[model samples]
Target: MTRYTPALATALAVLLPVSATADSFTATIAAGHPPVFRWIRMISDTFIPTVTAELEKSGHTITFDEQYGGALAKVGEELEAVEAGLAELGTCQSLFDPAKLAVQNVTYYTPFVSADLRKVGEVIDSLHADLPAMTEAYGENGVVYIGAPITIDDYLLMTNFPVESLADLDGRKIAAPGAAINWLSGTGAVGVAGNLTTYYNEIKTGVYDGVLVFASAALPGKLYEVAPYVTRAGLGAQYAGSLCANADWYEGLPDDVKAALKTGADAARDWYTTELETAVGVSLEKMAEAGATVTNAPDAMRAAWAKGMENAAAKWAAELDAQGKPATEVLTTYMEAMRAAGATPLRDWDKE
Candidate 1:
């Protein structure tokens, strides 16, 4: 080959480096919930910022377009939106899509495990990594499961009337989110499927006498104004949502870019967990300050409630098992992992 002139070589070198440098990418992340929700807020506050910083270290950068609070997808529509490429990433509320992402609702089925939110989240995320079926559910929906699962604090019974025992809930209507309604089985409470957004209005209007809600959400929704009696039932923490990315889009990313996104998700998990932990105490205090009656259900009542309930977890796993899904495997793995992590479950759904 003929040697290039000095000027030509200089131009070629400049062009070569420019071509070799990673191209910037733009990803749009969506969330159905508003920024007021800690999990959603962490997307902008921690995930985006952390991702930006991590990619910069590799000489690659990404510009994230945040669409939250139903701007792009309404509640329960995030998975479809991401799969259809409406959003490159989003918060997929598995609780809202139990029909499609059935195994992801394990914690909701197995209650009274533990109130340690961080442990619950960590265990579920680990399952997603360790189990093929866990991630396969997302792959089947054309989404990639990011490791950070959104976990909520312990569930409690918020009511207009005092609830010291399971007897207090007899014939009472209680609003509960999907899958969680099963928690009311054998407790004599009529479970009505409801969500946080409508809890206040429904309770105020007497559509339901009470709601199965967590403190972190109740304070923001101002549910105390309507259901002033709060009973800490210790119904257990839950993993209800996760950050996911469009499978095609995620697979097409450069390795470094992909790593950055995962790093961001990991960081967001810690941030969200810390924020949620802090918020729980603050929310309960705020509710109590707002003239709400907050009391802990006695140990006897908590035990009675657990024993009285139908084994929804076992039934749920068996149904999925019949469908040829590894539901029992996942259930066993999850319950074992929880116990290994120092959780003393009220009932071992997998074994029982």
Candidate 2:
């Protein structure tokens, strides 16, 4: 009887393999920010379906465990959540993950860098292709880097007061965080740490005179209602965000799955950029229609603001060096690469 039991168990174990022949895989994706517009919807509506369709053609069924609107994580926590495997993949905002993603901050420091989305996209692809250290950084956090270059529209200042000239900005409270604070320093505009999610309330209560933001986000946030003066400084553009995957999970995927994931990310990047191109123009028009004072920053104002950012680049490098990392080298490499890519950068930040 015992021998029969053993034989039966062995037979059942062998049958397990045959029984589980279904070719289905699950992908868990999370985004912390609310379901606002282009960014969040691109992943949900466009990228996921595109990847799923492609995967199906390869004889695999896919399921998405989507946790959008912060169901899985809070703002600034998406990457960390993905790192912890709370979700399989996610949108990681480098602007928020400063410590772990400082090298990614290269664009943030070098303002007026480039507004051409195609150029920005090419640079990002090149950066991933060239910078193993960036991959290493992502790896350190238990995630694999996937390039979905986020194209931020030109940065602008929207205020309650009409800032016609450099002198008009004097003594105003400007909401510009990180290296952006340097853009407002000595203009008598005090710098405050702020993001799009909170700028409205900040401006409503007079916490800030205006914000250093782009119309793409600012209009949707209804910031124009609070601060009607919109100044287009056109501080070039930037690679604002990225998509990443859990390293262990991503590395463990079959080659086809890996390819599909990349395809999905590329699609997302393309769709998001295209959508943003339309949105930026539309948002500006919307703001104007809503009675906002839209105008360009005076040449002297732009020059004065650019000059104010002189010390910040050096300050960032020194801060990074004091932490015992080769911050200066990273900064230089990025600048050189940008110039090689035909970007005539305004600030030589590495030496600043």
Candidate 3:
């Protein structure tokens, strides 16, 4: 064999692209919820694979270590986990972490706006992409907002007692998650702060008379077993959160790698919205077949419920505005987008 020389090695290096060596990367993705949830499922079934495939095209490979079901970070703590590098990425749930993601919780405060999950997802995802204010909180929290917005389906009231009208809700205790608790205002019902983790058990044990929950989660959590009276109150779909990456780690990645990550998130968003739409119908049907009474609230009652509620959006935005969080901007942008998309709200939340 010929003797090795520095000149020969240098020439070989110049002839080959650095990527020809195939750099490998390891990413740990975290989610508070388990794989059974569609958002988490999207991370595993779509995001990781899409990113891997894209990276492979550039002679790079990535392996994902998925930590879900609060294995790595509990609900409301995912952003902190990713920020601190406990995981490289996570589903930063705004609904649960309202203090940190105040602007992202705009949809939750602006109930009765739209029940279309696709519209809500599209508007919120677009806001994240085009609006700096929408993502400034993420930057401040040491995370970078990516795509894959988690859009919950239209919320409804499920209770053990029959709710025929607003009168039925008088003095009743209803549980709602995060800012959604404000939704019970002027309805004569007592709003209790709660989450999906405890909704079913709480209702069964007389802790809550009902829960304002979504169809996608309600069916899986088996809320129907305890709260058989399903009243479609039209609380509207909401933007709960999105995927985020550790700012420090993400900034250090190569441009190509960064691009791959975003592409994966887009794929996840599409997959999640599609799956959620189908699941909404399936969940409702399955729950009804299991002996739950599913009834749509009359138009008059729906309008009255919306009109009578306190203007939580204005109040919430004002509170965050005092904190310098651009909450009002987010609310206006979202409401305007929804109206442009053909949604006629019972009340103009931003205008009021």
Candidate 4:
């Protein structure tokens, strides 16, 4: 046992008192989707635990009240929920909130770039850090951008009928989500705007012939049941959503709490991406085992589809420029970054 002088003991008591009272905060995190979705699940499985662990190191703690599966907000309402303080944090789907987060939907317009979900996620997350415009967009909507960007695996077309070429899609009704509807332009396919939740019922009732979706979701949603034909169109992976915090709430957080949240986002991104990559392969195999006809769209057909589509990316960027946003600059920067990372895009949206 070590003995201390009265003066030394008094100094120790003073210093110990500082951390004795740990600041505790209550945060409500909401998501439109259920915990079945990988990203939403990670918020609990990875993010909350990681942040809790990190905060403990600094003698701070946060208790998260999870509200997922539309218990707090409906699909496409997460951003608003967070902005209005209905939820302190949320998974904001930029794909759904195109009018509010147009820039964050860049990957949707720039298709055929790369199929690497990890690369797409990291690149977009990096943009949020390097480009003030990226974060500023979220700020304008009353949210602080967190680092983890929820990216999906490569997109494929699932149809009731087989599609071996673009011609097959001619006069066929194809359901696409939000900005992805533009991808059907000049391909002779009639593009109807749709979302994942309605894909099953719509296709089952012939509301539409099929949908443009990804493997991870398609498998779980049992989209293969309605649309048995899976054409790997290589439309490219995409960054659809992100974790964000209410700006006002985030600003009032203790410094250590903020740091822990940031650190948690970073770790969650890594874990989520790895799990996603593994799930993609497994999901595809499972779909095939369930008797879904899975085929890789012929290279020539893919090239034709890319060449035939109208330059929606250019048009989208121009619209943003007209709105006084750095759309063109972002397009260029994104393409350059993709190329630098060894991505060989079939169509350089900015250049052509």
**Candidate 1 lDDT by residue in tens digits, 228-294:** 9999989999998899999999999888888988999999999999999999999999999999999
> TM-score of each candidate?
0.93, 0.87, 0.93, 0.94
The lDDT for every candidate, in the order shown, is 0.91, 0.78, 0.91, 0.90
* Model 4 backbone overlap count: 0
Clashes of 1: 0
User: Could you give candidate 2's per-residue lDDT for residues 121-186 as a string of tens digits?
Assistant: 667667776877455568778888776776778788899999877778778888975667777766
Best by TM-score: 4
For residues 1-352, could you state the per-residue lDDT of candidate 3 as single tens digits?
A: 9788999998988889767787889989888898888888999899999999999888898888999999999988999999999999999999889889888988888888888999889989998988888989999999998899999999999999998899899999999887788888888999998988898889999998999999988998999999999998778999989999999999999899999999999999999999999999999999999999999998888888888888989988998999888988888988898999889877899998
Off by over 4 Å in 4: 1-10, 13-18
RMSD for each of the candidates? 2.9, 5.8, 2.8, 2.4
Question: Which residue pairs clash in candidate 2?
Answer: none
Q: In model 2, where do residues sit more than 4 Å from their true spots? A: 1-22, 322-326
Task: Give lDDT: candidate 1, residue 224.
Answer: 94
